[model samples]
Target: MTRTRWKFARIIGIIAASILLYLLLGVKTYLYKASVFLPNAHPNEVWEYVADFSNMKYLNPTIEDFEIIEENGNYNHWQYTVQYKEHLSHWPYLPNYAKARFSIKPDESKSKFFIKSFHTTCLINDFLCLNSESEFSFTRGYSSHGVHCDEEIAYECPAIFARFCEREVKYQRDAIMLNLKRRFQ
Candidate 1:
């Protein structure tokens, strides 16, 4: 093949690879849902169980420790310290310490509770790109006999961090729902 033709072919190959990488890493989305039966408790009673931050330790398996830092009007802000072990492409192993603030609102009429949290994962020494801010919103509904929970989480980070955020949210949500069911039953 001619040298000029070879150069053109190489350029096209590079462009195609770049496009594929962007699609694989650039756009990501995640959602998780779970529901369990309460059997005997009223919806209002169940909402109260999930709304109190102090009960988080009993209801959520992912939270190592949490405390309320401020309260203003209907918004109560709290800080949570979370520990999770994760693996990265460039790192052999990584452990994360994350701090987050949660804003919660309790709706008695609907027997629903809503919480929004903003947090940043701890930084790895060599991988600064993994440190990113994430936002998560959770909605939980209680009926006379059961409860339903749904959560949405979004993170703005490089492709790697985005993928991690998606996985972590699902994991945490599932853990919390499982714990809640165990305690209530």
Candidate 2:
């Protein structure tokens, strides 16, 4: 082939390779943090609901079952069922059962509670999901009459398609927080 034609082909090949690599191996994991604040809400009263991880059902309607394997003061090892109604959402969560160790720490003022999760299993058998954790805090917002809840999710998965969990997580979190706001205030 001519020199110019050969160079043009090489450049095209490189571009194609880069695109393929990005599609196959890129964005396998994601970290997201979200928060909601409600005015005219009681902080301690809100903490009662937020401190217990089992209370997730109050926020996430998709949770069909929640079982506590072990429990102590402000700490629990639990498993819960997640229902993915639509086909698009069900594929990634093959097993649909999740297990995690969650804990809560409340400040002396009782205005803030920190909830942390560790050793979380996204799928029943730990299939496609590699690692995941949700860190959440419920506190008093700018005013004593207001309540604030913050959540951070650090998730990792080997499959590129598994990253879809990020959007789902954000949506569910927002839904639950809004539910809490309406319920309390």
Candidate 3:
């Protein structure tokens, strides 16, 4: 009985120490990038859809919902819920929403647009992410008949959560790009 109790106490102590160490871990940064070409999409129309923050629900599968906190001439401030796309057994600590300020600004030539989302919240995803920023550029096809889109994301999280965050981001991006293609072309 004494030996069994000692073993149990040691196990509990180890688990506690592991949890404490994880909580103390510093943030790990990640960069994600993806590009897509829409042959049947016109640059103007694509810009209209991609630049609108209100259309996030249609474009991103991970966005369960979004609320516009403020809107200016060329900028939008919104809060969005990021829920698990797949069935998660149980995760109560994950943040359900994040706040961000985004801008859709046209270039001097008016043929390209810079779209960005700057996370205003702590980017707290229950230790999954500490900070995040997204940028997208939509340019008129050089000589083709469509639009060229480039997307990049820079985020920081604990190293243990990096893989999961990266994978989730990629999955969401793939879905978003596919939806954009379907809607425009």
Candidate 4:
């Protein structure tokens, strides 16, 4: 009985230490980027849909819902919810909703527009919750081929777990952009 109890205590201690280490070492912020071009669309045409935060519902599949809480000029404060995957649907991992403030600027030539999210309440996901920023630039007049789009994400997470999920994040971004292209072209 004494030996069995000692083994159990040691196991528990190890688990506790592992958890502590993870909490300390797994926290970080990362910047990610992606870009794509729309074959037959122009930046002006795309801006109408993207400049409005609520339109993300049509562009992004993961965006279950989007509401414009407030708006002032080219700035918007919005509340949105992402579709929760099965594994992330439990306990604190499940988020009620996300909030973000975004802005849009038309270029000097009016041939392009730049949209950026200055702040967001949710980072990548609930498990890796932190502050995040996103930037998107839509440019046209490059020989009339199409509009070129570039996007960048700066995410600050308390856990590095999201690093492993980069592929999913990339796919999600691309899918949204693809949807935008389809909508415009």
lDDT of 4 by residue, 31-110 (tens): 88877788788776776578765677676656565566666663223323333222221233543346676677777465
TM-scores vs. true structure, each candidate: 0.59, 0.69, 0.72, 0.69
lDDT minimum window of 10 residues, candidate 1: 129-138
- Which pairs of residues clash in candidate 3, taking residues 3 or more apart in a chain or in different chains? none
lDDT of 3: 0.68
For all candidates, the clash counts are 1, 0, 0, 0
Better of 1 and 4 by lDDT: 4
* Error at 98, model 2, angstroms: 1.0
RMSD in Å for all candidates: 5.6, 5.8, 6.4, 6.1
lDDT of 1 by residue, 100-173 (tens): 55555656555566666665555564344333333332333333445554455555554545556556655665
TM-score between candidate 4 and the true structure: 0.69
Q: Which segments of candidate 1 are over 4 A away from where they belong?
A: 42-58, 65-71, 75-93, 118-171
Candidate 4 root-mean-square deviation in Å:
6.1
Model 4 segments beyond 4 Å from truth? Answer: 1-26, 74-96, 122-128
**Model 2, 1-185: lDDT tens per residue?**
99999999999999999998877755465788888887877666676676555577667766666666666653222223232221113344444556567666677466677767764444545454455778887778775668788888887654565556766666777777888877877
Order the candidates by TM-score, highest first: 3, 4, 2, 1
Give the TM-score (vs. native) of candidate 2.
Answer: 0.69
Write one digit per residue (lDDT tens) for candidate 3, span 79-141. Answer: 233322222113434444566777777773667767777763333454333567889888888
